[model samples]
Target chain A: MRVALHLAYNGTHFFGSQTQKETSKTVLGELENVLKKLGIEQKVVASGRTDKGVHATMQVCHIDLPPYWDDMEKLKKVLNKMLCDALHVKKIIHVKDDFHARYSAKKRSYRYIITTKQKNPFESDFVTFLEDVNLQQIQQNIGLFVGEHDFRQFMKTGSDVKSTTRIIYRAFAYQHKDYIVLYFEANGFLRSQIRLMVGALLTLTKDAIQAQLNGTKKYKIKPAPPNGLYLSKIKY
Target chain B: MRVALHLAYNGTHFFGSQTQKETSKTVLGELENVLKKLGIEQKVVASGRTDKGVHATMQVCHIDLPPYWDDMEKLKKVLNKMLCDALHVKKIIHVKDDFHARYSAKKRSYRYIITTKQKNPFESDFVTFLEDVNLQQIQQNIGLFVGEHDFRQFMKTGSDVKSTTRIIYRAFAYQHKDYIVLYFEANGFLRSQIRLMVGALLTLTKDAIQAQLNGTKKYKIKPAPPNGLYLSKIKY
Candidate 1:
């Protein structure tokens, strides 16, 4: 039977969500290790891959399980016990055999957190600290990416994708206590898309951003660090 | 010249605040390693030592420096550059030659954070989450720790302290958004005393807590984990 697992990970411990060659630590590699120990040699597929140092609060994945692992509660307990604290299976449910974690997703949401306060040791890993920022300026330009556009310039330099066009369902900025959160919802995003958009929002003017969205201006934009980015949700 | 430095450390990457024999990744050990590289071979004296995984936001330490390293700003910049991200020197100021970090401290403040929400990977290291807790009961019992008392029962075993009694200037609990913060201000604290007191506050009845403070009750109380405890401030 196939199972859909709701997962959450700190992401600081793992190299990234995707498994890599050689014995590098990644989210899938760690999960598969525990599954093999439980006598279930199955591969886990994530909804999407997250970059290194990125966190996830509601990342979904699909895995096939044997008949003996019918008790979902017991399976979740066992998985959590064996997995390290940085990774966890929040919930597990039976899914249709054809349900694919990556392909069946209709929407994905990402959030980038920014702190204007002085950098503190406790929050350094989760929130990006900026010495100076114009909140009103960023908020005004964030809505420019709300509609569908070809985000070819915003994609990471070396990534290969057949299509660079994606729909942005929603994009906005809000203040939550001490942090400013940038929320982006889309049907899909290219590699490093959100970070690049956030970087553009921080550095480029309104006209520059529009030119980039129009694919008329090609500027070398640096993607924001992954520490402040979180894969918040995936909807099917 | 003697200089007092205000420091902050995440503590998750550190074994403890004090230096240990062999190659241990300790706060002082890391700090001293950087100091030695700067050619300042003086030992650092902290206001107090925190247990493994106990964080500090304003831990003060005193170190004597050579006259060649007279630029305080330059010294701070060099120190921060050499130290790891988990450890930082927040501020530096010259002090009298007789000044000492531990001996001159008049009061120390510690804060314990408790979250009633479900455990999440993002906040697992900074906040202690409990599934079920009677907040009102813990609040009412926390006041019993105020004032002077024989806290021998609340200290960690095998700790060779000169005295077990200390004056508690203030003790209270307050709500901070999603967290319940327990604050304690005292002239001094024995090793793991706050954690033990917090454990009793959570588990023991009000009468039992009073008995423990009076030295009439001796319960083998397990101290709360160090991850949720922070050495917030030290006043001299």
Candidate 2:
């Protein structure tokens, strides 16, 4: 039987979502370890990969289970008991065998959190602290991202892809208490795309952002720190 | 010049707030290192010592400063720059020559947070997760802790104190969003007193708690984990 699991993790200590040769602390690596403990050796698939120090509130993944572990409640309880310290399985749903966690997803949403307040020790892992930011100006120009554009320059360099163009369905910013959240929804994103875009939003003017989106100009801006980015949701 | 500094720290990685003979990662150890770097060798004092894995929002400490470091703002900025990762110096204030962080303090307030929601990775360091807790029942019995009582049973064993009697000025429980915060204001606390009190509140009935407060009975409940404990404030 095939099933999809909704997962959440605080990725501060994780290397990334994908497995690595040097360590087994990656999201999939940890999940695979627990699955192996249960005598289920099937591979798990994720909807997308999040970078190191990035968090996820609603990441989806899928896996095949053997006939002996047909009880969903028992599986979830056992999985949580084993993996509750670093990762959480929010819910498990039975899905069609043909459904793929990556290819079947239509939209993905990410949120970037920035705080204007002074840096504190407890919340530093989850929020980016910036001083003297004009949130109103950023909100006014954030709509430039709400359309299809060639995002090659906005992604980390040296990546090979068939196309650099992708469709962005929505983009906006809102203030929640002392933090400002930047929300983006797109069909797909390139490697380090959202962080790079946020870096541009913080450093570039309206014309520079437009020129970069139009692929007519280039800017040298490092991507924002991954601690502030969260893979919020995915739709299938 | 005598000075009082307001400090806050996330004690997850720290052994405790006091300095240790073997290491320098304790709250005072780290602060002393930064002070020594600036050529000031005066020892720093804290209002009280918090145990391992406890957090603080407003902890007060005092030290005598050299004549060279007269500007309070610059001193705070330099201190924060050196210790921003694990500890923070929120502000610095000048005080009378006789002021003492430990001796002059009158009251301290602490908050223990418990959540009925499912366990998640992000908030485990700040909140405790419990199943099927009745906040109202705990609230009803919490008032018995107010006023003077012998809290010898609530303290950890092997702790030698001058007296086991202490005054709890206020005790109550309130709901905030998905969290239930148990607030305690006291003249002072014995070693692990608050955590053990919370443990008994969750497990013992009203009569058991009353008996424990009256020093007539003893229970063997383990102290609650320190991750959910925070020293919130100190009144001079």
In lDDT terms, how accurate is model 1? 0.91
| lDDT of every predicted structure (CA atoms) | 0.91, 0.91
After TM-score superposition, the amount by which residue B13's alpha carbon in candidate 2 deviates from its true location, in angstroms, is 5.3
Show the colliding residue pairs in model 1. none
lDDT of 1 by residue, A1-236 (tens): 99999999997878999988875489888999999999989888999999988999889999999998999999998998888768889999999999999999999999999988977778878888788877899999999999889999999889999999999999999999989999999999999999999999999999999999998988778888898999989999
Model 2: runs farther than 4 Å from truth?
A21-24, A118-122, A146-150, A157-165, A210-218, B13-15, B20-25, B36-42, B118-121, B147-152, B157-165, B176-178, B210-218
TM-score of model 2 relative to the true fold? 0.87
Q: Which one wins on lDDT?
A: 2
Off by over 4 Å in 1: A19-26, A29-41, A67-85, A88-90, A135-178, A204-220, B20-25, B29-41, B66-90, B135-178, B204-220
lDDT of each residue in B1-236, candidate 1, tens digit only: 89999999998879999999875599998998999988888788999999888999889999999889889999998888778778889999999999999999999999999998877777878878787777798889898988988899998899998889999999999888889999999999999999999899888999988988898877878899898999999998
Q: What share of the true interface contacts does each candidate keep?
A: 0.62, 0.66
DockQ of each: 0.53, 0.54
Local error of candidate 1 at residue B215 (angstroms): 7.9
